[model samples]
Target: MSSSTPADAGSKPAGPLSGILVVSIDQAVAGPLCAMRLADAGARVIKIEAEDGDRARDYDKAMGSTSAAFGWLNRGKESVVLNLKDPGDLALVKAMLARADVFVQNLAPGASDRLGLGAAQLTKEFPRLVVVDIMGYGRETSYASKRAYDMLVQSESGICAVTGTPEVPSKVGISIADIGTGTNAYAAVLEALFERERTGRGQALEVAMFDCMAEWMSLPLLHFDYMGVETARFGLSHASVYPYRPYHCADGDIVVSIQSTAEWVRFCTTVLRSPEFAKDPRFIDNWARVQNRDALDEAIHAVFTPHSCAEMIERLEAGQIAWARVSTLHDLSVHPALRRIPVEMPGGEMAEMPRPAGRIVASGAKVPPLGADTARIRAEFAGAAPAAAKQA
Candidate 1:
């Protein structure tokens, strides 16, 4: 709501969060992606980095100039370098936040306190500032001091237990715990902004990767608690859902799901051409089918394994069964649902990145070069009061 460069005033920001100024002190996935979502929705995000910049910038250098992760997360942000330990540099950031509607940070626990940028302190000092803290674990717990990474959170939250085959536990391939925490932070910021509009005040919010992942594991937790049913880790198969996994084809596998008895009936009678299998006592209902999945799958393999991909797909279409072909990265590169836009690399060359999820369609400007806007920003705010009216 402050006029200190939420976006350049003449031309407008595109989405609901337009003109929302965000000052982010962050590095790595959870923190950067949280701010990235805000930037995607038209917030003017100032990404503060150390003198070396975000380490992710050099993470394999796969995006022609910058790391693909850095290119994706830091797009459309104004990069500014600062050392919070230095009084002058710290003052500069304070001025930036003075004008910012939101402040996000993912410093190791207690690091914010060491820098005097703690959420409790910031929100108290500037009541209209929405402060979001991303952590590995809840601050109130003993694990608060423990270092957290995506894999660690996944393991701790029991996600690893349910993710892979029970004999060999494995973490998710993607940084899901980090993404979950980041998305939660993003949603929390929106909720806080809505409340700020009503109350004319802002609040501090926290989302830990561990806590967020635990919440995501709630259904399995409930099952484990009430029925003592620890989920089995069947590759590509849901622990509870029957016939909701890949069936062997000649070349590979085609995933299928049957959520209802009628769908199961269709799958058995139409797809497998075995009408009696649907009425078999051992595979009558979802639970029974789940219990007898190994036998049913063996029978299914006999029917499906002989078919080519084309024949399997044709049968699937005719059967009206819900199914999908697993797409590799090659397939995904040109998929119909994938949307991408050109982003200017550190150099003038352009690289494409995926658009933001959901319907808030926007293509942001070039990702800023490391500290590219630093001198201009410093010159503007040099003699500024703590209130940040210098920008105005």
Candidate 2:
């Protein structure tokens, strides 16, 4: 990887996000994740950052001094650090926006509006541009003005309420709130793009982190609404489904989900070595297993006790049952499906990071280096020269 070439170096061919120009002013996860998805699909995304750059750029240099978050989400895009407060810088960004097909931003509440870069303003100026506004909360909610972080939204959305051990609630370790909002925003932008193709006009999208995660919490809310009781944190167990959780094996833990009665019959016959057990009155069906939960759990434990994790996996495979290994973070780093790419940094350092999971068949696709296209962009946008970079 060289400074003038692939910032995060990879040999993969161009992807589907190719050709489309996406201009984004973003910090942290949500907006970046969305843009990254577009980039993965072969979009020519330009990430316009503050002069200091996205805070995520410095969020822990885990991958040999390169921020893991940045290395992950920022690949396949050009990074242009500009001070939006400066008139020249603002003009430069607006110039880019004027030619952009999609504009995304995740600034503080009312921040874009105050700067006259709100969706309304942008839509008026660029009627064909799809403007996506990513916020932490719904624009008119009670917590609209309140600050929201990833974990905070997860907690407020009742995800924490139903996660972790019963004694204490815990937020999901990952940024579920931010990621979910970004995913929804991406889908909305795609839908808006499709609509624009027919109407020849763009649409404004408002995606809130709290709302996205809250929508995921709907099932638990519905349970409480109809049953007058909230779902409890049972750790690895399904809140409403019995025998659908991890069980102890001799050397390690294995998770198994017997979702259907037919599969449960196979499990009893092959894994449990007790075909008649499936016909027992106490464990005849899903509801019976739930009603005789204690007995059912004990029976499952007995069947699983003598086997090791690998042995249990084999049994589950033989029985054609769905199973999982309780893997650790360390284990995932070397997971067979993991893909890594090298990114060129300022100090002549190259950092290898995971590639975004958007595999498309194309050629000559790559991530641009920081300011690599600055002079060309200036010349092209200032109307002093022809486009210095290839269009699409």
Candidate 3:
């Protein structure tokens, strides 16, 4: 939002999704993120929220005005307040959906069907609407109705089993479950849109957080199933690969990954200052090093502890070692590789944020204030004269 990041570079890209209308009854991360990406790709997203607004609006004040999470996922969208329990307000949402090209929601299990808004109902009624439904678990799962948060899903999907130290398993720092489900739902919507173009009909799609996380655990699952290897937690180190952990230096920390025999040889010779280690029987190959990982780590640690982070980085660069400096959020904020987009906050305050992933070029990503478009939406959907509010 700051002048540091330029806005109004040009008209927003005419992305492949142009002319699409996405109407979502959503909250929290999953549904919002799905719709957010649609908006980023040029679809006009109309967000429906409770009269009290999305509880995520108050998740935190990290963004100065609105919740950092809310602002990040709700950009480039219109906000409309609708009390689903009220007949009149519910009618408004139904009216909008009738004209929508896509409909996405993430309510509790069976809740959509109870409200007459489930994908089955919507897709059948509106043959051209691509309906997306996200859930905590797959529809047939026993615990489909059990509430699921990010940490809960991570724990259930085996992410926690491999995430932390051997002393105790820990959940991932980020909400991979919700994000993964959201991303999957977004992709499904795009696929459905394409299929609809050819078949002249839309389809209903489902994405479950548990299912998404389970797919992400494919590597470990394969090892456990076929190889009978239940990989243990290695903390910051690779469970199966030796010498992959971070080494503390005189100033900071750096992690080096010796993925190949040549890299391991070069690391031992140039960085560890011990050419003999490259040929030592105890550490000759990846298997040998992994077998004696403790010894290998101790040897590397002994060499690295005496040098400064900068000195180690310089040597690693010269030696062609694969390495990375451990970075904090402070480092990431202004990192050379980070790209930021200017955003208008809920209250018209300007702030800058990391741009969403992908190569799609677009602009005019605005963070809407809660229910900012409710009156305008009512006027437009009720077939009245359009209000001054900007559509989408």
- Strongest candidate by TM-score: 1
Clash tally for model 1 = 0
1-392: candidate 1 lDDT, tens digit per residue: 87656323334356677779899988889999999888878788888899999988998778777888788777778888888899999988888777789999998889998898998888877888999999999999989999998999999999999998858999999899988999999999999999999998889998899989999999889999999998878878988998898888899889988999989888888889999999999899999989999998899999999998778778778888889888999999999988887777786668877776685445436777889888877876676675524323
Candidate with better TM-score, 2 vs 3: 3
TM-score of 3: 0.91
TM-score of model 2 vs. true structure:
0.87
Candidate 1 local Cα displacement, residue 326, angstroms: 2.0
Arrange candidates, best lDDT first: 1, 3, 2
Worst 10 residues of 1 by lDDT: 4-13
| Model 2 lDDT tens row, 1-392 | 00122234345345444446788988889999898788777677778876567888788867544576776676667777677788877777777766678899999998889887888888877777789999988887788887788998898888999999989999888889988899999999999988887987887899999889878988889878997867888888887766788888899888889889889999999888899988999988886786687788898898888888888888889999999887788988888877766665543466656665555323333434456656655655564221112111
Q: Give the lDDT of residue 98 in candidate 1.
A: 79
lDDT of 2 at 186: 95
CA deviation > 4 Å runs, candidate 3: 1-13, 279-281, 360-363, 383-392
User: Model 2: residues >4 Å from true position, as ranges?
Assistant: 1-17, 339-355, 358-372, 383-392
Q: In model 3, which residue pairs have backbone atoms overlapping below 3 Å?
A: 1-351, 1-352
lDDT score of model 3? 0.82
Root-mean-square deviation (CA) per prediction: 2.2, 4.8, 5.6
